[model samples]
Target: MHGLAKNHLKKILSTCSANRDCEYYPCHYNNQSCLWCYCPFYPCEDEVLGEFVKRKDGTLIWSCMKCNWIHKPDIAAEILREITELTLDKTTECSIDYLENRELLMQIKNKIEKKLGKSNAI
Candidate 1:
């Protein structure tokens, strides 16, 4: 995603880290593996987004049936909503499974605190 604000990245990191239960899944960026799980809420039927079982090379495997709506999200807005339990407007596009795990959250917390200092509100 381009045009990502600094605050967006910060938010994504924190919210994803809120869930320490699951391990972060790896991603492919710049032709390399980037182990960063990017989902916040627990997996459920409601959150039953879609499934993609691709070959090890990331090729498409198979699929079932679901809505055809395709929308990319903003990692920042999503994290803020997930962790803080706040709702964002529909216009707010948070990343899907971007800030998903606790490590990402800790990272965001550290960065925010470092920038604004310990007394600053995130």
Candidate 2:
């Protein structure tokens, strides 16, 4: 493939679709793909997408397996772009700070939207 085509292919490979034939697949409603099997912005405090559950052992678990926000194509692509900008390639740790401080997240979103020349539609 040409260099430009190869570049586009690389972008797609950044978060490809999950296997549809696998059992226990389509874990979320609407059959959203699990491209983000492990969310980078995990431990988030998005009450709409996740919640905290206390186990019998008195340990709190952040149950987010059912959240399909990251599985959406646009969201996944935007997240990958933000990660690239943040230079988080070699980072293994993520913070819940963005949850508490939404400014950071909003700044990134605004920048991305401006770059794409898109309005922040609801």
Candidate 3:
């Protein structure tokens, strides 16, 4: 892994905790992992996992409320591992930027879909 990514990943992984006391405890399901309170893959735009909803203001925004993929412990761990491995050769100003790379995002999505035997609808 890249030096920066390794350090950042270590920091993030170290802080993983289940905040069951939060008001939104079990936000997605009874046993969902709280490691990702805010999804790193926001606005993933993956129709299978999420969709765009139109608000009363006539504006549409991606809603992942129904998606529980990342909340699964195994999936979350796999995602972090994939991210670390994928960034081994790439360089970015911020380690988190790797998540924003289109190709990397697609790869992560594909892996999740494969593990779950689902197809992408995006």
lDDT top scorer: 3
Per-prediction tally of clashes: 16, 0, 0
| Candidate 2 to native Cα RMSD, angstroms | 7.1
TM-score for every candidate vs. truth? 0.23, 0.55, 0.69
Instruction: For candidate 3, give the lDDT.
Output: 0.73
Model 2 spans with C-alpha error above 4 angstroms:
1-15, 88-122
lDDT of 1 by residue, 10-109 (tens): 5654434332322532121221111123323222122233455677897964331231111112333333544444224322345334445556655554
User: What's the true lDDT of residue 39 in model 2?
Assistant: 61
lDDT of 2 by residue, 2-120 (tens): 99999987665543665465475666644454566676556665566679999999999898765666676676567667756665544444444333356666566456546553421
Per-residue lDDT for 1-122 in model 3, tens only? 99999998766654454456668877787766677778777878978788999999999999998887787777767776777787777676566675667777777767876876443221
Ranking according to lDDT, highest score first: 3, 2, 1
Q: What TM-score does prediction 2 earn?
A: 0.55
- Comparing 2 with 3 on lDDT, the higher-scoring candidate is 3
Q: Give candidate 3's error at residue 118 in angstroms.
A: 4.3
Candidates sorted on TM-score, descending: 3, 2, 1
